[model samples]
Target: MKEELGRTIQQLRKVQCYTQEQMADAVGVSVAAVSKWENGVSCPDVTMLPVLARYLDTDVNTLLSFHKKLSEAEAASLISELSDIFFDSGFEAAYAFLLEKIREYPGSDMLVLNGAMALSGAMALSSTLVMDGDQKAAERYEEEIERLYKKASESDDPAICSQARFMLASRYMGREDYDGAEALIDMLPDEQAYDKRQMQANLCLARNQLAAAGEIEERKLMLAANSLNMVFVTLIEIAVREGRLEDAQYLAEAADSTARALDMWEYTAQLPWFELYTHRKDRDNCLKTLGSMLASVTDGWNYTSSPLYRHMRKKEGEERFGPRMRESLLSAVEHDERYAFLRDSEEWNRIISAGGGTDRGAGQDET
Candidate 1:
């Protein structure tokens, strides 16, 4: 019986273009077990038989037939459908469905791992969705995220483990549990973690913001310079809000020098930096920057649909800079019809009616 079963397993595996190691990995079993099953030295237990059948895309009865009881084409179709569901809808939804299928065909590691992956994916998505600052939602997301992380960690697949760790770190960040976030991040492989140049720059900005918030004044000029050069526009907004005009100016200057050094003088970074200059009562610089930006608006550099740009143009017009600003405002109206919708929006009307002050009261910070 073992010899016959091994023969059957070998034939089915070959038909599916799977190596023993590949099949073993997919089914969460050992290559030795697959080898034993194929060599007729041993047959899998009754529990593992259903798992093997599912993994090889055949029924137990057909597998026991010793000869072809099912067509290879039919088995291929079933395998293709399973692969599609697993890849498309992701692991959780597919796993939920597979769990029901497992009940009908018990003790199948093929179903188990597939279901586990689906469950993991569902948990990851849930964590991401609930990542907003809701305590109850965060708790729920964290629970599921931890469960998936544990499961993935115990699995042989290093990729899945890495992904789970990344998601866990993200969840920790969402909950403002920076210690937990750091722990998880430190555990990740450098290649698997958020260590891209842009990401590192953003991280520096976040750390600087945290330092500023905490009033930890050690005067880290390098930190400020790196963050401002990478994420100057955001710093400019913060500066404007906090009435830190000098800091904003310094940051903008640093960003401008970096942009020029990188030969990106007409980059998107310049637009908001120009707005920052406008806030600093530098109308000449703002006008000059806007003029340069307009000239650089080729197919590659164009971003006419930006609402912020429209708002900036409106502000520039109100400042009575010149006809050039007026023409830009007119061009914005002509290009993006979405600006028309924005003008008619209730929020816009309320803002206009309140003279740009919120109903919550002026000088009331909602941070």
Candidate 2:
């Protein structure tokens, strides 16, 4: 044990480019004592552990080689911290910080996967996207994201690989590379059992609980539903690119249905997502989609809170949208000129009036 601890100390010191004299000086020990510790002729007394860990940029337990795997909460905190860095420092700084942390914790698949998610979200959500025909900047983020996903896919841990494969599958779908997406999804099992021998070791290491068959399917369902939501958006975009307005509408409807089934109201914002209705002079479906949005959000339907899919939240158990959600969606669509055709329709007036529109709020249904 002493020799193992000495070896770890020596390795960390050299990796940090610290000489025996420099390390000894930093830790209030003699150069001879540092040499003795590295040679396994002696151990650092308990008093020196904190100083050594600080100098080496690690904790005392790790310095003493008494390492423990990061618990679930610790892993979550790390991911959250990385997210905050991106928000505060911009993507370039965050990316550099992430790579540094990955090197600092090389074996943690959780860290790698979470970092990949952060990068991908930053890319998709950034509003200042350069729309050069090729979207070269977007491609860079996507490429890096794919590289990180590949790294996680290669992990021996099923928990990590399952999520990586799902994200990669969604990316493939977004690229319209259907075969690639399907192939990745195929890698996931239809069911996994807590008592299953093959997963016992992996489960024991990461979660320490067996995933029951029901739990396994629930995970797959959530993954598939979420991935499919994005996948349909990709398909809709492709249809729009090809100028197939009807096809885009059909795809949007399919995506909306799937989202409703999963209770992922986030997709509701995109109900009439494509601008094709106004472009093609198709008013009925446009108004219909808008009406559906109104109905979906009316009477406090709780679109984002399906018990089965609550885990899909950006913050678990928190409402993804606020009470102002209905107002925001209605206002955006109502003000868009593309839907001006519906301005005088009785159904449209009633839709507006029901939502406290000054035109006739008194006689309208509160719902």
State every prediction's TM-score relative to the real structure: 0.31, 0.46
**Which 10 consecutive positions of candidate 1 have the poorest summed lDDT?**
308-317
Prediction 1 TM-score vs. true: 0.31
Query: What tens digits encode model 1's per-residue C-alpha lDDT throughout 1-367?
Result: 8776786687566545578989999888899988988888887888887888898787887678534332434433333444446446743445445434433332222333344444444433333334454557545544643554544444345665666677667767977999989997897876545534445445656877543332222123223434555577877879987998778777766777675454342534465565675566454454345444543432132222332122111211122222223333334423344345335445545544533323311111122
Clash pairs of candidate 2? none
